[model samples]
Target: MTAKRRRFVRDNGLTLAFGMAFLLALTGQAFAGHAEFNNELAADGLAPIGLAAYLASSEFAVDVTENWQSEYLQFFLFILGTVWLLQRGSPESKEIDEAGPESDKEQRVGQYARADSPHWARTRDWRQTVYSRSLGLLMGGLFLLSWFAQAVAGSAAYNEQRLRQLQRPMGWGEYVLGADFWSRSLQNWQSELLAVASMAIFSVYLRQRGSPESKPVGTPHGATGVES
Candidate 1:
């Protein structure tokens, strides 16, 4: 590879790795989902859909968005919760004394900003305020968007299945309030919350020698938010 290409890969190795993993997993889901969907069609005496058709179906959209919404919700809550909540001995939290958005001087914004600070960090206006909380805003926005997508696509998919089973199709509002929607949503949500809880609590006692996610092996358990 070229020198510039090597440098780019080194700089963004983590994102690249996960992006590739996401693609692989998505591909696997598409194929497996298609097969399962076709099996349902066969049982119902309906024609099976092609791979392209299955990929574009509301069933696929609902499945994807259901998980997406939950994942975003996890990060959304984590980002906002960490502002005021501190977990002693957990590397995922702030030091107990640092619970809230700290002073401007500590954050190096406005007059206290260094020469190399981001442009918004040096500005003293609404723009700076908005930029400061942008990460949490983005996570919350994505969660809402994906959750709405799940509701819409899930309603359509559920109604289609209802029709196939000789049952009455439901309106969007009724479908959204039904057990199907809540089951799909809550199942994904419970798992995400558990994973986040595990990460925060596990880091307190775990030691991953060089990983930034864990505290240094020699650090005391009482240390909070100290990345290696």
Candidate 2:
């Protein structure tokens, strides 16, 4: 590889690794889900669908969107929550004494912005205001979009099963208000919340030598927000 390409990979190793892992895991899920779907079709005396057909089905769409929505919701809530809420000794949180948006000087925005600071960071107008909350906003927007997709796809899949059983298919409104949608949504939400809580609590007592997610090995338990 070229020097520049090597430097690029080294600088973005974490994101690149996770992005590749996500694709691999998704591929694995597709194959597994396709097999399970075909098994159900066989048991129902219906013809088995091809992998491409299964991938385009409402079942697959709903499954993918439900997980995507939940993950985005986790990030959205975490980004927003960490601003006002804090843990005493967790590296996952800011210092216990710091809560809410600090002054422009503290954030190095406006008059306090360094030469290398982003343009919006130096602005004193609405652009700065919007840019300040951009990350959380984007995550929240993605969550809403994916959750809507999950609901629509889940409704279609549910109605498909209903039609197969010779039952009446409900409207989208009814489907969204039904037990299945809430069950799917809440199950993922609970797990995501639990994970964030676990990470915060665990980081307070555990050490990871080089990971940003954990405190340094010799860091005291009372030390909050001291990343390695």
Candidate 3:
């Protein structure tokens, strides 16, 4: 590779790697889902859809958005919850005694902002307030949007199945409260919550040599919230 290209790849390896993996996974899902969907169509004596059609279908939309909503919900809760709650020995948490947002000086906002600080960090009004909570706000907003998309798409997909079975369709409100919606939502939610909980508890005892997510190998398990 060219020197410039090598440097660029090295600098962005993590994002590039995950981006490629995401594309590959999404492509695989499209193929596998299309096949599974065709099987259903076959059973019902309906024609199978084209790849483009399947990609635009409610089944695909709901499947994608359901997982997205759960992921964003996990991050939203973690971002907001960590502000007040903490686990003593987990690197995933703040110092045990340092719950809640700290002082403006500690955060380097307003008068405490350095020359290199973000413009909003130097502001003293509503802009600063908004910027201060922007992370949690963005995460929460994404969670809401994804969840809403999941509900809308899920309703359409569910209704299609109902029609296939010769049943009446449900309204949006009724469908959202029904077992199908809750089952999809709760299953994703349970997995996300378990992952978060596992990360917190596991970090308390585990050591990952060079990862920011874990304490240094030599660090005591009792050392609260210290990262490598």
Candidate 4:
């Protein structure tokens, strides 16, 4: 590789690695879901769908969005919660004494912002207010959008199966309030929430050497937010 290319990769290795893995996992899910969907079609005496057809179908869309909504919801909650709530010992949390948004100087906003700080951070306007909460805001927005998409796509996929079974189709409102939609959403939500909880609790005692997610190996368990 060119020296510049190697430096670029080194600078962004974490994001690049996870991005590639996400694509690969999504591709695998598409193939696996397509096969499973075809089996359901065969059982219902319906023609099996092509891979492209399956990918474009409500089934695939609902499956993807349900998971996406939950994942985004996890980050949204974590970001907002960490602002005001804190754990005593977890590296995932701030120092126990520091709760709620700190002073402008601590955050380097307004007059405290350095010359190299973001433009919004240097402002005292609405833009600064917006930028301050931008990460959580974006995650919450994505969660709502994906959840809405899941509801719409899920309604279509559920009604399609109902029709296959000679049952009546449900309205969008009905499906969103129904058991299937809640079941799909809740299942993913529980898992993601559990993961966040585990990370926060376990990092209090666990060591991960050089990982920022964990405290230093020699750090005391009572120390909070001391990343390696």
Candidate 4 wrongly placed segments (more than 4 Å):
none
lDDT of 2 by residue, 1-228 (tens): 999999999999999999999999999999999999889878778899999999999999999999999999999999999999999889989998889998889999999999999999999999899999999999999999999999999999999888878799999999999998999999999999999999999999988889988889899999998898
RMSD of each: 0.9, 0.9, 1.1, 0.7
Candidate with the larger TM-score of 1 and 4: 4
**Candidate 4, lDDT over the whole model:** 0.96
Which window of 10 residues has the lowest lDDT sum in candidate 3?
Answer: 219-228
> Candidate 4: TM-score?
0.99
- The CA lDDT of each predicted structure is 0.94, 0.94, 0.94, 0.96
Model 1: per-residue lDDT, tens digit, 1-228? Answer: 999999999999999999999999999999999999999999999999999999999999999999999999999999999999888999899999999999999999999999999999899999799889989999999999999999999999998999999999999999888999999999999999999999999899988999998999999999997998
Model 2, position 78: C-alpha lDDT score = 97
Clash pairs detected, candidate 1: none
Q: Which stretches of candidate 2 lie over 4 Å from their true place?
A: none
Output the lDDT of residue 58, model 3: 99
Clashing pairs in 3: none
Cα deviation of 167, candidate 4, in Å: 0.5
Error of 2 at 215 (Å): 0.8
**In model 3, where do residues sit more than 4 Å from their true spots?**
none
